[model samples]
Target chain A: MFEGREPIYQQIAEAIRGEILSGALNEGDQVMSTTQYASTYRINPATAAKAFAALESEGILRKQRGMGTFVSDGAPEQLRSSRRQSFFAERVDPLLRDADVLGIGADDLARYLLTSASDASSATNTDQNNA
Target chain B: MKANGTATIQGYGVQISDLAVRYGSTTALEGVNLDLAPGRIHGLLGRNGTGKTTLLSVLASLRQPHTGSVLVEGQAPFEHEVLMENICLIRESGDVIGDVSAADALDFVEVARPSFDREYADRLAHSFGLDLSVKPAAMSRGQRSALGATIGLASRAELTMFDEVHLGMDAPTRQKFYDELIADFAEHPRTFIISSHLISEIEPLVETVTILKNGTLLLSEEADDLRRRGVTLTGPTALVDQAAAAQTVLGHTVVGSRDLGPTRQLTLYGDLDQRSLDEAERAGLQVGPVPLQDLFIHLTDA
Candidate 1:
């Protein structure tokens, strides 16, 4: 369940963040306790606790004093915003670099993005209509 | 039994200072000083003949250190009645009554170890598919290992050590054993020292890691810290060399580099700061983590 290359705690934190971003976990919903994470992932509880601590420090999760850890209020929005802040550097810059390496011009990339964006929106609309 | 009456018995911490042990004329361990914090799963790693078993034996009171003091939870474990009971060491050979039935072995441990839980042991045995009617001597090697694992888990000793006990079990059985260990540890928080050659298998389960090299302590660190300590860089040879110049390169040759051409990969053993990471990224050098298993091999290479 965990990759060996990076720290398990960091991976766990990223997983929870991904869950929040994907709407799998909602604000105010109680996340799995460290014990649950430990058993499910076959990892040490301390490692899970460390992940929770990192999330807590980032206000992505909050502990309710003996009850359990819950997704912080507006956690999804916070995560989305932070991800939005890094999107250009983490996503677009790499895309641009790859395009440059492929000898693709900026205009061509722009045209491709414009077409892809419309296609993605139309796909979303079709899914909404099906729902 | 007095300790068992308590709902929660915290695991014992260990303090070893200037410890040395000798077997006949050969010295097994020397100048060893280590402090293991309580209530964490620690991975003891080493190659063959590196005093891993010797250190565990000393901790379990099976053998006394010839030179220095060894303390468990504050008091010396050697010859101490209560401390000895709290410290259980399960070896790869499965330390149980071979002649007695598997059920009877549990009964024996229940009598000797105050913390032994019969109900839990029964449940574990069922999960491991260990037949209680069969004697350990009659069981296969894997079954014997399962029996040993059952005793170790059910013992619930404050400080439990498994000295390569999982080596006998096959892959799926080892997986089950690790899962059970994590689950049980969650319910009952205690110190665990697992010494095994399967570094990658146990990497996720250990909070702290201690590596021994030929009768001496090589490195003792938090598992997470150790993971971050070794970084790998792979890219253009000039870029990789430039990035590695500022860091502590682990070895002379690149780990997986072939042909010594335009691209090269180097393993470095040290913490890489954020600035250096950003620099490596800008330079088009791919920075990756070194697995604990690889790091162990590199550090313990003859």
Candidate 2:
């Protein structure tokens, strides 16, 4: 459900990417029909179709001759690798550099990360248990 | 479709680069760049006095951008007669000669616009119950709008732009305009740019939207992406903050029984995870999507 902000093609690309990342759309899962997506989302079928086409181009999704689009087998791992590469470039490296500038020792950073991770894991477990 | 010897339909990408213009002291547009594709309806969105008219004028080659160029098919629109002929810029007033009857104006348009189909214009006028003998000055505001609509539909310009042509029309007329516009586009594909303040009303027609604030392009986004990108969250400030952490916020306000409680209406940009969405709902916040109008106001308001 995007609004008019960035180019719709890019937005469509991101929507498909989100679906893949969430695992709700698994490998070989048939992507939503473009026409159905268009009506349900109240967007132009052409635009919804553009998103699907982009995914197909990226090798994240593939289309059958008579059937609809299905998630590619390698899509998950490929997306994971690309995201991981971007994560290091966009986040991890900058964070480490910031820590170095702040004169935080490696050991100190390790402790902080360990503690935060533990806390997050425990919170997630507690939430899971509650659920 | 060819109405005369010349073809009315010619699709081309519009690439406006470093476009700047000023009207006396007012900066109508400044250093604007847009790459609008062919055959898609683009919404030029802005508040009152935000230079939407100026940009459209430049695009249509009615006026030149002071510093840059409007490119139709990679050529300057002002210099390209064929490209200029393919654009129909329908203004709000649709100011035709007062003395000329509606039929005369339509006839003139048919001759002036190579693509104007006389038969189509006549059919439309007949369908709308428009009297050909009625001069524009003698007609009601709605009638004038109808005439403009007729011109727009009949022009069949590759790039047909409507700038608030139905502002004063009734709701039914506006709805009719929307339906007719969509149906016409399906039959005859072209690039349509509609500049309107009625965001929610015309949101369905716009495939992509470019928003301007103080003559600057703030956002150029697809309608679908924008819907997915923004969310409205309401709850305690702490809970809201927690849910909205790491998210870009468009705007937020307070709402409660006291009218001055914790922040209740928070418009966030970026997708919220399932946990975050659930947390927001659990915090007694009515989490939902914000409309484009609200987002526009939030983004443009000082």
Candidate 3:
């Protein structure tokens, strides 16, 4: 039973989300059919259908009537925008308060982030070249 | 603590305390304490002999708790008309009048429950292809179960508890039940506690889970939190074991040896980042996460 700690549909949504984030599932890519997901996950078809329906509502995926569900083009961009909107209020402000408590300034954090971003971009390029 | 009659209390949830029920020397429930909130779907799960039924019976006041008090909306439920009307507990075996037909049973429900929706009941009966004239004794087990389910849903009780009521149902019918349950909840929000052994099957319908193990409440965690708290790592036995030494092993299997098989599987109650994944892969390991059932079984068994 997939009855762990969390609503089951959220888990299904996150699984598809992970695929999308990792580029395994590209925008406009056909996702698993509802029946396919149900059988693969051993869940009721209705449950799997709910998850897909939720993604459709969020505009991450769209249904094609009898054709099946497809990931909406620019879904990754939409997801990123939505997450960033929440991140500043939910995470950055708290981090800033912690920084104030620890006597860390904005300049110090900015420098650190800049260095990290450069390193990450270079690492990604190296990985792509290797692949 | 005072025993009030059922009709006087409303909006409050069901409560049980120091509840102990014993059959001879065997204790079905031992000093258990639980408070079921209203309007949310709660999941009750435990092993076959671990007293899930006993607890529900006591909460519904169908059976008296030997040593403690049970309350529905702050009133005793046994023989209490108002509270009984607001509560429906569907046991594993359908609880219906054996001599009465399905239609008669629905009529009885209409008299008993103030919130009973006649149209909904009729629709459900028709959808299930249940004959209103057929007595409970004549119907198949699945049909009998459906009759009970239909009554439970259409009753519109403030608190509804289904204890594996769909066990006799076929896959398609069961799926229909699951969807209808949610659809009903959407139209009218109420407290629903569903107990079933098929965790993966009905996982989507549950909001929170109360896990029981060997008669003790093991954990009551939000489903999402549990999913985020664990992972599965498989690879070389030595490396996998070493990595998982500091964590809990929910389950494991011998997929293969050093070169060809999955040497070990580890479940950790925390997140593993890409770096951790890379480290594991470098050590010739495969990493994943445990599903809910695996997590439940592992946690309960321990």
Candidate 4:
């Protein structure tokens, strides 16, 4: 699950962030302990601990004295806002760069975006209607 | 499972200074100095006859260094009963009782090593598909290795060193051994110095890496730091060459330039800063991390 160029700890922290953002791990939910992560992933417990420490420092995960680690309250919302804050720079700028390389103007990119957005909404609407 | 209470015995830290070992006319190791911090898995990597085994032997106190001093937990291990008892070294040769059944061999270890856990040993043997009733002499080479792994794990010594104990185990058995090692280590943290040629397989399990080259200490550093130090850049030959000019380029290869216009993959050994990485990405260069195995190969290349 952690096949990445980045350090394993960073990958682990990113994975937890993804889980929180996807609503798979709700706020206040107890996460797996470092020991569990170590055994399950076959990684050093110290590496897992480092990941946990980073998350704790970022306020994404909080440790209760002796009870284990849990997702900090409002972590999901906090992550959403921060991700939203970086969305344009991290996502759209890259898309625009690729478009520029392809010689596609902003107008064509906007048109394509609108088409795909509409298609996505229509698909969701179809699912709702069927339900 | 109840805590063994031996958790209080934190792993032993090792300090080796100017260690040298020789066999008559041959110098096995020279001027080796290293400090292994407590309670972490250290990967000892080197090619054949690069003094990997000799270093381990000195640490295990099987053979004294010809010069320099060695300390385990701030005390010399040779002839030091307490320190020696806490240090266990298991080699690929399966240094267990070959004439007796595996069960008896384990029983003997339990009696010998104060911290040996009989239940865990039995569980490990079962997981590895080792028949306890069979003597080591009658068992397959893979089974013998499994027995060695079982003894090493069950010993639970403060400073445990496995000198390529994965030698004869099949792929599945080796995987089982690794899993068991991690699981047991999580419960009971201790120092582990694992010497293995299977660099990639042990990459994730090791936090520290020590490489030996030609009877000398090459590099000893955190595994993550070493991983970050090596970067593989693949792009147009001109762009790759331009970007890698200031870096320590380890090796390069040109492939599939017929259709893609002179592409080259350059493996550089140095920290490529974030700005440089970003620039490379913007330039459409595919940058990848060098696997530990590849880095080892490059670093120890003769």
Q: DockQ of each candidate's interface versus the true one?
A: 0.60, 0.07, 0.08, 0.60
Higher-ranked by lDDT: 3 or 4 = 4
Candidate 1, B-chain TM: 0.93
lDDT accuracy of residue A47 in candidate 3: 60
Which run of 10 residues does model 2 chain A get worst, by summed lDDT?
A: A1-10
How would the docking of model 2 be graded? incorrect
Residue-level lDDT of model 1, residues A23-130, one tens digit each, is: 788889999999999988889988899999999999999999979999999898799889999898767887787789899999999999999999999986785476
Higher-ranked by TM-score: 3 or 4: 4
Winner on TM-score between 1 and 3 is 1
lDDT of 3: 0.74
Give per-residue CA lDDT, model 1, range B1-302, as digits (tens): 42454666669999999999999999999999999999999999999999999999999999999999899999999899989888999998677899989889898999999889999999999999999999999998889988999999999999999999986799999999999999989888899999999999998899999999989999999988887777778888888878777654433334444325788888777656646766786656778878899988888896
In candidate 4 the C-alpha lDDT for residue B208 amounts to 95
Alpha-carbon shift of residue B66 in model 3 (angstroms): 2.3
Q: Tell me the spans in candidate 3 whose CA falls farther than 4 Å from its real position.
A: A1-131, B1-12, B228-230, B236-239, B246-263, B268-286
lDDT of 1 at B89: 94
lDDT, candidate 2, B59-143, per-residue tens: 8877878797778767888867787778888888565666789989988887888888788888877766678899988887777
| Candidate number that wins on lDDT, 1 or 2 | 1
Question: Could you give the fnat of all candidates in order?
Answer: 0.70, 0.11, 0.09, 0.62
Per-residue lDDT tens digits for candidate 4, residues B1-302, read: 12555437668999999999999989999999999999999999999999988988888889999999999999988888878878999998577889989899999999888889999899989988889999999998889999999999999999999999999899999999898888888888899999999998999999999999999999999998998877777878888777776453434332112225688877767656656766776677777787999888878885
How much TM-score does chain B earn in each model?
0.93, 0.86, 0.83, 0.92
Write down the RMSD of candidate 4 (Cα, Å).
3.7
